[model samples]
Target: MKNQQDHIHIFSGEIADYWIEDGILFSQSKPIKRTVPLIQENIELVKKITQNQAMPLLIYLCKSPVPDKETRQFSREQLSQVYKAMAMVSAPGLSQLIMKMVFQFQKPPIPIKSFSREESALQWLQQFK
Candidate 1:
């Protein structure tokens, strides 16, 4: 069972719980230190969810431990493999701070944005659909 919103529960991945609605992929990230193997598992789940089609992703924010270099590299290289664009919905400033750090290290291969409200994030993700 899940919170009502007509959400389709897809899977409870190693890193997140996934669902899809409105042509967008949604994830509630787990507070876990993402690893290369875990991210790989997530990629497989995502491909299966979208039937090998990349689509916009909306991630609910969680405080995850910083990943290791190998894990980070793998995650960055594989993002475009499953997501065309990404929208992170979080409380004010949290996503912004994290994104700033990510940009400083390396620009994401796909368009990404952060919003404080799920409605706004979903509205923005609609453009990519």
Candidate 2:
């Protein structure tokens, strides 16, 4: 098994930093802030990582507030193509609620869920592996 940080790909944006381990993509992001070119860059990196094989993904949103319309739209448009499943780690708060609502409305192509702990997120993602 790879160490948690072995495949981390640190990004230059406030949106998130990503990594790949055991065919799963792990992304850690802060609260919704500037999310323009950084998100695009992150998407490109994800594409590169999963170029040959699709992988499940887990996103850890630390203190992430609800995302704005533009950022939500970007995710709705781009995420499903690269990942088979996505799990998000966030506490029960506005961010989690908003994410659930968005998922309900946008209906991403792959399966998605939110958990309050990293272990739970990883466990959920494992089914997709």
Top model number, lDDT:
1
lDDT per residue (tens digit) for residues 1-129 in model 1: 125365456678888888887788889988999888898888999899889999999999888898877877788799899999999988788888767655668889999999878888888888899
What are the lDDT figures for the candidates, one per model?
A: 0.84, 0.70
Residues 8-124, model 2: lDDT tens digits: 665434476667777788777756664546667767777776674668988776665555678777777776667888887776774467567567576677888878777888888
TM-scores for all candidates: the values are 0.90, 0.74
TM-score for candidate 1, please give it. Answer: 0.90
Please identify model 1 stretches exceeding 4 Å from their true place: 5-7
Candidate 2: clashing pairs of residues: none
The per-prediction tally of clashing pairs is 0, 0
